[model samples]
Target: MIEAIEIPTAAGTFDALACGAPGGREVLLLHGFPQSALEWEFQLTALGGGGCHVVAPDQRGYSPGVRPEPVADYRIEELIGDVAAIADALGWQRFDLVGHDWGAYVGWAAAAAMPARIRTLTAVSLPHPAAFLRAMTEDEDQAQRSQYFTLLRKPRVAERVLLADSGAGLRKIFDWKIAEDRIDDYVRRLTEPEALTAALNWYRAMHLSGPTGPVSVPTLYVWSTEDTTVGSTAAMATERYVTGPYRFEMLEEVSHWIPEQAPEELTGHLMRHLLAHRT
Candidate 1:
């Protein structure tokens, strides 16, 4: 079973769901926006079965303890710092890392900034920030795919639209990927005004001034063919940014919600990657 606990970070305290055994090699799983640590339900069980400790956190804005009022507090640097703090709180000097969507973005930044602290990186659905920016500007398909981000950048409008009708707007975000029970949990967390704003702050403070160079750690980039949020151009370009051993896995007919939609395939990829590069 996964246990929820509060982890104190540099920015503040955040909630994390821990599974598997303690004192084993740590694997930190970071969930994306509008989601919590529950995103890694399958992987947590699988990895635990393999005697690996898994810690999946709600992240800064998503966790009630760490939500900051200022939008700037959610910058990439700050987000990375929060992950670092969580690692520190857990007494993990080095650990395997996995992230999805916005969590993947934070994972990239953290791995880049502190290479020694990360054993391997598995980023789901999103590419490196530089690769994403290049695609956003140079690829028309990527630009078209990212149009929803523009809508989300609007402060109150995005919140109201998502929270309207008892989170009907947010419920549609899950569509066919997430189960009804899971969607209900996301709705409950996001209904908190601060939680909603803190999640959106990630979009608001996204900037171009972070590390864009190649990642020095072993990495895995997972992409889905049918994902509406990322295009082929950006997905293909992700390989160029990794200087270390890298693997790319493309799932056919899957959407952006990979952990929920294709948990078996995702777990298979993760197991292979982890086994191939165990430290």
Candidate 2:
């Protein structure tokens, strides 16, 4: 059975779900905006069955225990620090890292900021920040695609629009992409005013910061062609930001919800990436 646990951080106590046996290699799973650690349910089971312990956190502002008020509390540095605090709380010197969407953004930054604390990185959906920024500014397609972020940056209106009609607005965000049950979970979370604001703060706190420099750890980037939020330009440019061994896997016709819609394939890519570096 998966167990929910709390880890203390400089900010507050963060909630996480853990599964599998102790004393095994640890995999730190981080969930993205508008989602919780529940997003990693499939991966936790798969990795646990493979004799790897997994810890997936809801992250700050998302977890009720660690929700901070000010938008500045959700900056990249603080987000990355939360991941580090999770690792420290578990007494892990290093662990395999996997994250999706905004979680992937934090994972990318964390790995880059402290390469020694990460064994391997599996960044799902989102690419490195530098690549994304370049694509956002230079690629008109990306700029157009990201226009929704401008709306999300707005304070209370974005929250009301998302939570209106029992979160029908949030449901429309997923449309026909994510599964119904998963969409329900996302809507439920977004209904909470603080939760939705915290998630959006990740965007509001965006700055001119680049990727923490080229990552030295072995990494795997999973990009989906059908992802509405990311484009081919940024996806393909991810390789340029990694200084160490890297593998890029492209999922054809898959949406941003790859972890849920294609868990087996995602797990396969993650297993391959982690196992390849075992020896």
List TM-score per model, in order: 0.97, 0.96
Q: Write the per-residue lDDT of candidate 2 for residues 1-279, one digit (tens) a residue.
A: 688888887778888899988778889999886788998999999898898989998888888888888888888888888888889988888899999999899889998999988999999999988899899999999998899998888988888888878888778877567678888987787667588888888878776334456777999999999899899999999899999999999999888988987899999999989899873
> lDDT per residue, candidate 1, 139-258, as tens digits?
999999899898798999999898989989898987658799999999899888678988898898875335656798999999999989899999999888989999999999999999
Candidate 1 Cα outliers beyond 4 Å, as residue runs = 208-211
Candidate 2: residue 132 Cα off by (Å): 0.6
Q: Residue 51 of candidate 1: its Cα lDDT?
A: 86
How far residue 277's Cα lies from its native spot in candidate 2, in Å, is 1.1
Local lDDT at 220 for model 1: 95
Stretches off by above 4 angstroms in model 2 are 208-211
Task: Return the clash pairs for model 1, or none.
Answer: none
Please give the TM-score that candidate 1 achieves against the real structure.
0.97
lDDT of each: 0.88, 0.87
